[model samples]
Target: MAEARAELQKKETELTNAILKDVSDIVDAIGYEGGYAVILRSEVVLSAKKELDITGAVIRRLNESKGKPKEAPKVKPKEKPKDKK
Candidate 1:
């Protein structure tokens, strides 16, 4: 029974370590500035921030494209009609 108890404790510690690792990874990905606030306020804020950044990047690209003139698609010159068969 003592051996079984030791095994259980080991397993519990492993599980706790795994959870902490995941949380740390999440915190690191979210960054330090607003990450703590998001964790304290709402857990979904991290995902929201990620999505907002993606959307903002896409919008910025689209706006930049709109400001630039579209280039004509390049067409390679035909090979002189294949120089006769």
Candidate 2:
């Protein structure tokens, strides 16, 4: 049971990291395209101009791109270490 729980936790963490990465990628692209100097999270900011907020734009972009294909990261196989006799 513990092993299963650990596996589930691991999977959850992977999913979270992947999701965050995708969102971060989108945010970075938006920032670059919009010529934004910086983008702040709502949780961290006490106040900001409404025009500076890009949360809605990000959400809209995500939604619009849903069902579209994304390129998978290419991973190289790890090579075995050479053994010294």
The candidate that wins on TM-score is 2
Clashes of each: 0, 0
lDDT of 2 at 13: 100
TM-score between model 2 and native: 0.72
* Model 1, total clashes: 0
* Candidate 1 lDDT tens digits, 1-85: 9999999999999999976675555454455544444333344455454443433433454456448777999998876655656
Instruction: List TM-scores for all candidates, in order.
Output: 0.38, 0.72
Model 2 lDDT tens row, 43-66: 999988898989898887877767
* Cα lDDT, all candidates: 0.58, 0.90
lDDT agreement of model 1 with the native: 0.58
Q: Which candidate leads in lDDT? A: 2
